[model samples]
Target: MEQAEAQAELRRRALDYHAQSPAGKLSVIPSKPCKSQDDLSLAYTPGVAAPVREIAADPEKAYDYTGKGNLVAVVSNGTAVLGLGNVGTLAGKPVMEGKALLFKHFADINAFDIEVQARDAEHLIDVVAAIAPGFGGINLEDIAAPMCFQVEEALQKMLDIPVFHDDQHGTAVIVAAALQNALELQGKVFKGVKVAIVGAGAAGLAIAKMLRALGVEAVYLSDVHGVLHAGRSDLTHWHQPFATAPAHWTLMDMLADADAVIGVSVRGAIPEAALSGLAAKPVIFALANPDPEIDPVAVKRLRPDAIMATGRSDMPNQVNNVLGFPFLFRGALDCRASQINQEMLLAAVDALARLAREPVPEEVQQAYGFSGTDGLSFGPEYFIPKPLDPRLRQWVAGAVSAAARKSGVSRL
Candidate 1:
């Protein structure tokens, strides 16, 4: 098939797949039997009243009495639906449902995708806060930036449960992990390297902060205008911390001789000419979905020694958020964590990085259709573990739970 035909076919199949299954992707099934009057009594009404009274008295007993311990609310306003922006709440339902599916499939966690029709940031925050008592954690998804930051911060302050904006921290955790392995493969040290992060939105800002916490020497951030420099009038409060020194530096200037270039921006944002100026054996993570900041193939052609990754599944070393959020929330919910903090995120990053260095299992190799007798292992093409690697639930969740406990955030 031609490229356009292939794309058209994919669109048709995706819509059919979603439409074929009970009209949508998710449905609530009772965990307890409701087949008989005896079971019904225990599941609701008189017997259920006992647990309700206990929870009313103690509050903490709700975790034991209800699904509150295992349930996550995947809340969003539908302002930013992947590459398609501001498609409205109803249009964004499918993506949110997909997230819920991932939660159940990947980590055995139950999720209710809540698409809130709030008027503004504060309204969305209020809505999430009001409904937060029913969930163990809140996975904020697809809300636009600035507002996303506001909503997350407000919700985190008001609610005791883990409130995570996956667009920001989820992408950050996976990227940090992959970068750790990528740098190691190139014999580069994090503390000595200068990093350039294109697209200073939620993901870019979060990644820069995470890398700084991991002891990277300096991180230069850029948006549509160019490199974020001090005194730029367009800089929001969130962008101020990432602002570089007052210099007339373009995105190309920031990329010049940089040890690593992380792209969370739109397609073709990084020109071909810029790739040639990168440091020897540079790590390039062109992580924009569907289309990346720079084409991976073009990057390889321009600089043969460069280590490359994209958000596309077909590409090698894909920095996917699915690798982080499900298991991260699983650990947070398991330990009754109050918040998913930076410490927990870093723990997840560490687990992912370590897991990449270990010998890959046969199941993982088969999942990705790798037929090599040597088995799947860490290299330029395989810096991070595949999303289907079953071990992620164990390693990431364990590490996150441990970090939560150590950070004094875990109620367990």
Candidate 2:
């Protein structure tokens, strides 16, 4: 009864918070002053025409004359939103707006949340491509798997500005960073460790690709049909790359000898029996949102030697995507990157891992309500840098911008 009441209170508070005056989490304000008559004329009629003409003559002038360079369109079709599956466009606005809010707060990037009524991947690509000129980058959010893969790939090929599906790559970057630190802390070699990933959706597949690209050779992925293998006829091209040769393996079989098991699936996806199969001092990243695949407490009981991470903010080593998107876009926007590529992603992963090993700043400790000696340090419990860390802009964003420039992807 108490639990039910607590949930009810939370629901009420959330609704009320969103419902409060202004009615939404975001707003548009004039970056340039528009108070006086001269300012109004310059902002609207006469002066606007000058920059408009300049942009018309040379499209690249849009960056110099307007906010286009720092603007990102957070586009979504609402096929997948948070832990709520297939919430539709209208229902997904809050999540998109929250993303916009985060983008603004974290990296000072101007984001406009755009929820489109896309029928399919092609429709989404068309819609985003049509509006691509206005934004320095396009951030695809909350779209479901298979379709998301298509939409992101198509849009990236079609548009020059960075087109990123944050659900896929953002999650992948943070997961890689966390795993890097976790592996090192446990004295496990990156390429030597075996990983079992539950959930072959957007996040799961992206993580698998990233880990492989980072040199982890043995990566096993599982979906609703059990482990992905060459024997599975239901597998698509997206799933085929990560599938093993052939096996009658269950989720447990994958975990049996895994040095790390990452879960991006729903709650209770990791069975209690699987915990016993993990190698000594294993890394467990059960990152299903709202709830994890296995309860952290349960994992602790099963294997006291295990280093566990979750999607929950209250937990240690939280694999949050906020640690990725803002800084990534910040770097991309700053550099005028043509696209977000593997080199940039790898740079972000390295930067985050490097930041985690550095000494925690006092302001960062204070942001999370910690003080003095009650601060974080580099260890199993603090492997991933806190999302509130101030150094992220300098470290991660700087690294990404440099990588973009080095890879010859920077338009500037």
Every model's TM-score: 0.98, 0.98
Cand. 2 TM to true fold: 0.98
lDDT of 2 by residue, 1-412 (tens): 9988987998999999999998989999988998899999999998789999998999999999989899999999998999999999999999999999999999999999999999878888899999999999999999998999999999888889999999899999999999998988899878889999999999999999999999999999999988999888898899998998358787778889899999999999989988888899999999987789999999889899999899999898889999999999999988999999999999999999999999999998888778887688998789999999989999999999999999999987
Worst 10 contiguous positions by lDDT, candidate 2: 244-253
Pairs that collide in candidate 1 are: none
Error of 2 at 345 (Å): 0.4
Kindly list the per-residue Cα lDDT of model 1 for residues 138-166, writing each as its tens digit.
99999889999999998889899999999
Q: What are the RMSD figures for all models against the true structure?
A: 1.0, 1.1
User: What CA RMSD would candidate 1 show?
Assistant: 1.0
Candidate 2 ranges with C-alpha deviation above 4 Å? none
Model 1 error, position 289 (Å): 1.4
